[model samples]
Target: MLRIHFSSGDLARTRIAEEPDPLWETVLSLQQLREKSREPVLDGWRRRRCARGGRALRTLSPLMPSRGYFPDFLTPAEGSGGLESGIDAVLSTPRRQLCGELELLADHNPLPSEVRRLAEGETGALRRLGRALRDYHASVLEPGWRDIASRIEGDRRHRTETQCRLGTEEMLRSFAPLMGWQSPVLCADYPVERDVHLQGRGLLLVPSYFCRRTPVALLDETLWPVLVYPARPLCSDTPAAPSARLAPLLGHTRAAVLQALQTPRTTSELARCTGVSVSSASEHATVLRRAGLVASTRQRHHVRHTLTQLGDHLLTGVQLGRIPPPSASRHHGRA
Candidate 1:
C-alpha cells in the first residue's frame, strides 16, 4: 500500500542521522512533566490506559526548521519501533541523497541573488525561492519591523502558496515518467452534485510531494494501472465508485475563484474579498462562470454573482444534510 518514489542526497541524510533533535527531547520532557502533574488524577483505569499507550510512544520528529525541508509523507507514524525502522529505510534508500541535498540547501546560507539565480528554471524552483524568502525574512527582513505581526501572516500565505505550487509541479514532473503522467497538465471534471448510493466519480491527481504522512490512493477499481502518459493523455477507463468524502480541489484559477465566491457575494466583492486587483478577479470569474457554479449580472459598470441552481444543489450535496437552513446555500466550498 506504500511506495516511495523520491530520492534524497547524502548531506541531508547525515544531518538526519546526526542532528540533535531538540524538539523531540522537548516533547518527551513535556509529556513526562504532564504525567507527573496528573499523577494525582490518575485512577486505576486511567493509569492502565496511559501505561499501555506510553510503552510504544517514544519520541517526536523535530519540527522542520528550514523552509525547503518538508516532512516525509512516506514516513510511518512516529514511535520507537516505527521511527527507527523508517529512519533506517530512508537512510538506505535512494532518497538518502535527496534528503541530504535538502539539508545542505537548508544549512548553506546562500546569498539571496545566488540562491535565486541557481534555482531559476529548475523544477520546484519556487520551493527553493521560498527557502530564500524564509532565510531573508529571518535574517534581513525581520529588522524592518513595521507591523511585524501582520507582515509575518502575509508572508506566510505567499510562501505557502508558492511552495505548494512548486512542490506539486516537481512531484508531477518526477513521477510523471514512472506513472506515465504529464507535467503542467490539468486534470479536471465537472464538480457534480452528490447523489444517492454514496457515489461520486470525480478523479483528482494529487501531487505526491504535497501528500502529507502517506500517499492516498482513491483509484483501485477498474483503472488499476491508471496509465498517465505525457502531454495530457486521456484515460478511456470508466470512473470508479465514489466515497461520500469530498474530492480534492484542483489546483487551478477557477477553483480559487469559486472558493472566493462561497459567501454569496458579487464578483466585485470577491476581488475585495481576496485583496487582489479587480482585473485578476474578472479573469478568474470568467472561468468560474463557465464551470456553472457562479452566475453574474451586469449592474452598471460592475457585475454581481449569486450561486446558480446547480451551485446551490452542489452545496446541499456537499453538506450531506447537515447544513443549517439560513447559511446553507451561502456556504459553498469556501474553506
Candidate 2:
C-alpha cells in the first residue's frame, strides 16, 4: 500500500497535471510493453510491435523491467514542458545524481551491459539513453499521439468536472476501488509498502494512459511529489461512428461535433475536427450548451467545449444501446 499523507497546505497546493507528460508516458508505456497485461485499450498500441532489434527496445529494456524501481531522472519534472525538453532534462542529469540513482537501481536488480555504462557515469552514456527514449517515442508514441492525447484529455476533463461539481476532497474520493481517500492520507495499491508525507510541497497527480492497475511514484522522496496514475478510458481518438439513433436524432454534422468534443476543443479547433466552418461549430456548440449536453467556457476570443455529465451519459448509453429517448423531466435535446 502507498499512503500519501497530506497537510492543509499540501491540500491547497495539490493540483492535477494540465496534460500528459511525455516522459512519464514513455517510461510507463515501455514498462507496459515489457509486461503482458494485454489490456484491450493498449492492444492497438501494442500491435505496433516494438522490435527487439530496434535500438530503442534493446537499450531501454534493461532499465524498464517488469517491476521494481526505475531511475527517477528518466522522468524529470521538465517533462511537463514537452518531449524534447524532457529528453534534454534526462540527458543533462548531473553526474552525482546519475550515479546515485543508477546505484539504487543496481542494488535492486542486476545492471545489464547497456546500463552499466550509465551506472559508472561514463561519457556520452546519458546521450545514448536520450537517443533511446526519443527513438522509442517516435516509433511508438508519436504515431498514435492524437489517440493518446485525447484519451488523457478525457480523463483530465472528468477530473475537472468532478472537482467543480463536488469539492476537491470529493474529487479525490471519487477514485474509489483504485484509490481510497481517508482525509489526511490517500491510499493506493502498490507493490511495496511506503508512506509519502507531502509536508507542504503538495502532490501533482499525473494521469497516464499506460500505467495500468497501479500508480507510480518517484523512489526518491526528496524531489517534488508526483503520482502517475492510470488514466480512465474515455474514447478512441477516432471514435466509432455515432450510433444509428445518435446520428439520425442529432443530425450527422452535430453528432460529429459532439463526438469531436470527447476532448475539449475551441471553436475553430472544433470546426477543423468536425469538418465544418467556424460559424457552424459555434452554432452547434450553442445549441448543445442550451440542451445541457455541452458546457462551454470562453477564454478570450475562443470558447472551449466539453461534454457535460448529461452529454457523457447520453452518448455512452446510446452508443451501448442502453439509453431510451429523453423525457421532459430530464433536460436535453437533439444534439
Candidate 3:
C-alpha cells in the first residue's frame, strides 16, 4: 500500500494534468515493453515494436529493468514542454545528482559502463543517451501517437467533468478500486507498502494510457509529488456495434461535425473534412456544443472542437447500437 497524506491546502491545490506528459508516457511505455506483460491493449504495440529491433532498445533495456526503479531524471517534472524538452532536462542534470541517482540504481540493477559514465556527467555519454531517447520515441511512440493522445484527452475530459459535477473530494474518491481515498489520505495498492506525506506541496494527478496495475509515484519525496494512474480503458472488452438511433436525430451535417471531433479539430478543418462551409461547420459545432456532445475552445484565431466524455460515451453507444431513441421515454407506461 502507498499512502499519500494530504492537508487542507494540499486538497485545495491538487489538480489533474491538462495534457499527457510525453516523458512519463515514454518511460512508462518502455517499462511496459520490457516486462512483456500480457496486457491486452499493449499486445499489438509490443509485437510491432519488437519487430523493428534497434540500438535504442539495446541501450535503454539495460538501464530500465523489467521491475524496480529507473531513475527520476528520465521523466523530469510536469510542464517541461514535450519529449524533446524533457530529454533536454535529463541530459542537463547536474553531475552530482546524476551520479547519486545512478549509483542508487546500480545498487539494485546492473548498469552498462557507458550508462554509468553518462551518469557521472560525461558529456559524450550524455549525447549518446539523448540520441537513444529520441530514437526510442521515434520508433516506439510516434506511430501510434494519435490514438494515444485521443485516449488521454478523453480521460482528462472525463476527470474534469467529474470534478465539476461531484466536487474535488468526490473526484479524488473516484480514483478508488485502484487507490482508496479516505479524507486526508489516499492509499494505493502498490506491490510494497509505503507512505508519502504531501507536506502541503499538493499533488499532481497524471492520467496515463500505458500505466497498468498500481498507480506510480516518485520515490524521492523531496521532489514534486505526482501520481500517474491508468486512464479509463478506451476499448470495450467486446467490440461495439454501430448505433442505429443517433444518426437521424443529429442529421447529416451535425453528425459529420461530431464524428470529425474524434481528434481535436479547428472549425475550418472540421468544415474541410465534412465538405461543408465554415459557417455551416461552426453552426453545427454550436448545436453539438449546446447538446453537450462537443466542446469548442478558441485557440488564438481558430476555434478548436473536441468531444467531451459524454460525447465519446454517446458515440460509443451509437457504435454499439445501444443508444435508445431520444423520443423513447422511460415514463411512457408509468406516471
Q: Write the per-residue lDDT of candidate 2 for residues 128-204, one digit (tens) a residue.
A: 88888888888778877886788888888888788788866767865643665667778766788899999999889
TM-score of 1: 0.23
lDDT of 1 by residue, 150-188 (tens): 322333343235435565333333221122112212121
List residue ranges in candidate 2 displaced over 4 A: 37-53, 235-335
lDDT of 3 by residue, 25-144 (tens): 777887887687655445665667653436777877777666778788877883347887788898888898798888888898878889878877999989988888888777777777
Minimal lDDT window, size 10, model 1:
10-19
Off by over 4 Å in 1: 1-252, 313-335
Candidate-wise lDDT, in order: 0.34, 0.79, 0.75
TM-score of each: 0.23, 0.67, 0.67
TM-score of predicted structure 2: 0.67
